[model samples]
Target: MNDMLRQIEPLIPALRRYARTLLRDRAGADDLVQDCLERAVNHWSQRRDDNPRAWIFTILHNLAITRLRSSASRPRHIAIDDAQEETFARAPSQEDGLRYRELLEAVARLPEDQKSVLLLATVEGLSYAETAGVLGVPIGTVMSRLSRARERLLKERDGDRGAQPVAQLRRVK
Candidate 1:
């Protein structure tokens, strides 16, 4: 319906921006938005009268959350597309590239819930409240998980298996 289109039309860019922040890839984010739009069109009859924007956003947010969770569970592998630009930029040797790949793999090994919360909060720049709304959790839970995720990422980045204090390294290895 024209009414539905008009309401959702303005929200597309916002949806895409949020999705891009969540997925960290423009194409993946756009695809997620398209899927959300398709679902909205298909289920238009079921939508309630109030706050169509929130409803549509909830759908998109859920889809992105689900996707991030699933991606976290898969076998940890560095994304080729993600690495290509960095590879070209650095002109690193094969050995250095392998080290970078290992770092990515370690990040992938983190708990899915932590990864999702961190990405939603830090990468997407969502408010704690917004992340909680998107993730169906309390704001406190989001904050705690974000803290844990940062800690875990720091440990992995340092290759420190113990709870030792991490020293800041100015140079990239």
Candidate 2:
């Protein structure tokens, strides 16, 4: 038990980071992490030791899905304070800030599965296999999702598709 805590302690920050990315709400993310720890501690002794990191992540992932589903059935609300707290950028100019915000919105708009894979692999620095185990998906699926996620993010960051320039006509003589 003591050995387990030592190993698990290091992963908490990473877990919180991943949760924050997923939830986009600091309080919600903290709640998810708290729920994850509570569940892990409750089932600590019975859990398999082969991959404790994956197991704990799996718990966090499952709890996030449940919350997302429940929230979907109801109207979503974002407190102004939480939204302000979520931004990490200190913009040099308003244009840069706008671009940064757009990029973040693109990420938040990502499909949940792809978002999870991208955050787990890139943000959390998990190996492909570790991500697969955490999400219970195949390695190929993780690769595929990650690839698609990057492509979509790039596309959104590049342009506003279907946007057209407006034309003005001078007054006729």
Candidate 3:
């Protein structure tokens, strides 16, 4: 058990990073990582010594997927702070913040599966094979989804209703 904790200790940062990317919020991501580590600690004694890293990763992946699925069934809405919104609205540089807002909205528009793959690959810096393992998909599928994700992001950012005109042009062009 002590050896298992020692082995799993190094995975905490990686787990937190992956969780943050998956959840897109610091508090939610930390909760997810905490949940994952708790599960890992509870199950560590039963784990085989062959590949602990893969085992922990699999647990985290499963938890994130399950939560995402659950969240999908609900209506999507951002819980913006009214006060902050009002303050920002009154700010002189509101235009700059609008671009940030638009980009975030575009990201929110992505399909969950594509977002997951993109986050796993880019934010987590997982290799193709590693992402495939985490996503339980073929490497080819990972590549295809990643390509599609990039394409969709470009389209969203470039559409007329997207962010500021100059920023959209810079992104699309």
**What's every prediction's RMSD, in angstroms?**
8.7, 8.0, 7.1
Instruction: Report, for all candidates in order, the number of backbone clashes.
Output: 0, 0, 0
Worst 10 residues of 2 by lDDT: 84-93
Higher lDDT: candidate 1 or 3?
3
Candidate 2 is scored at a TM of 0.79
Q: Clashing residue pairs in candidate 2, if any?
A: none
By TM-score, the candidates rank as 2, 3, 1
Q: Model 2, residue 82: displacement in angstroms?
A: 8.7
- lDDT rank order: 2, 3, 1
1 versus 2: better TM-score goes to = 2
lDDT of 2 by residue, 1-173 (tens): 78778878898998899888888878899999999998998888877765688889989999999998889889877666657733655655688778877877888999989999988899888899989988999999999999999999987765665376758788998
Error of 2 at 51 (Å): 4.0
| Model 1 regions lying over 4 Å from their true place | 1-30, 40-57, 64-106, 160-173
Judging by lDDT against the true structure, name the best candidate: 2
Q: Candidate 1, residues 44-112: lDDT per residue as tens digits? A: 888765556656766887898788789888865667766656545754579878787665566566676
Tens digit of per-residue lDDT, candidate 3, span 106-155: 76678877877887787666788877887789999999999999899888
